[model samples]
Target: MSINKTNRSSLRYQSIKNDGYIMERLEELAKQNPVEGFWKCYGRIRNSGTIVNHKKLHRLYKKMGLPLRRKIKKRLPARVKEPLAVPAYFTQTWSIDFYE
Candidate 1:
């Protein structure tokens, strides 16, 4: 009860300092793309030759309130209208003009 192997196994050395460079880079990217979430940012960092842990980026992303993507509305297609052939003379045009 006083001591256990499980507790001993869980213990591990932790880094005393975090690289401010990664944090600063992440913040800058987030500013540029406010909706970019952890995974995307992590991918960018990796692509840029930075190997920061994803979990750390996730925590920081949440802390900074950045999301993966924004909800953008899809653009609607325009309606196509056919050109009307107007008759120059009133007698030339005839219809069951119920609407008019």
Candidate 2:
């Protein structure tokens, strides 16, 4: 089966319209919840009575560049290297042994 050019163009137009509406909704959700990730946005949309497929939603989510930035872990300051303290006399150190 083959589709004529007009029909193909019409279908494309309809798809574009639908995509535009979904994109707008996604953008609005993103704006309202800037820190929320894609799944949260998808859940909000789903809870709003819109039955969008997760795959499609993910595609649009990625297409709109709406992925949340990952938080970086804070690094602790470097410690000063110090020489290990050694007992001058063997009697100064104590050793413990454990037995089961």
Candidate 3:
């Protein structure tokens, strides 16, 4: 999900200008109080009626060389296959394939 680029630019700069100090302070608080998720921190700031744009915020994070923590993808556990013994020292062997 994403906001339109024009909308983001319009809102982001306006938000920065209107609440630059608050945005900066939020950054400081994020540093000092280190939240587990950066997006969550952004949400907190958004709740403050500030105009901070996600694209701009992300751009700054990129500029500062900060890594965004990606959520680990959940995977189903692998199914365990039972071992089978085949008899074929010198004898002919037959194999079969079945479709489900």
Candidate 4:
């Protein structure tokens, strides 16, 4: 291995910090607002004075499986077909056009 001994030793001794606090906060927000997406949750956390980076928050959010479900648009009902009535007289339907 061509790696520096000091760098390898530091990497071996590095400890990972617990992110439980942020995860709990995110889960709480999700429970309170199930319809809102990640950005809304991020905004709420930011407003509460937590300065978490968006990318980190997103990663944590994904890790916790908190993605919002996409809503499907409702299909419009089919329009009723109506038969057009023919005028018996020529003046039965009058149209006026104004030129500007």
| lDDT on C-alpha atoms for all candidate structures | 0.77, 0.87, 0.64, 0.91
Best by lDDT: 4
Task: State the lDDT of candidate 3 residue by residue for 18-100, as single tens digits.
Answer: 44565575567568666445677667778877667887776665555454567799999999998886677846667699999
> Quick one: best TM-score, which candidate?
4
Model 3 / residue 78 / CA error / Å: 5.8
Clashing pairs in 1: none
Off by over 4 Å in 3: 1-23, 32-35, 69-80, 83-100
Model 4 poorest ten-residue lDDT run: 1-10
lDDT of 3 at 20: 55
lDDT of 4 by residue, 19-84 (tens): 898999999999999989999999999999988999999999999999978889999999999999
- Candidate 4 at 68: error in angstroms? 1.8
Model 4 residue 40 lDDT score: 98
Best-to-worst lDDT order: 4, 2, 1, 3
TM-score of 2: 0.57
Q: Give lDDT tens digits, candidate 1, residues 54-86.
A: 888787776766666666999999989889998
C-alpha RMSD values across all candidates: 9.6, 5.8, 13.8, 5.0
Q: List the pairs of residues colliding in candidate 2.
A: none
lDDT of 3: 0.64
Query: Which pairs in model 3 have colliding backbones?
Result: none
Global Cα lDDT for candidate 4: 0.91
Output candidate 2 Cα RMSD. 5.8
What TM-score against the true fold does each predicted structure earn?
0.47, 0.57, 0.42, 0.65
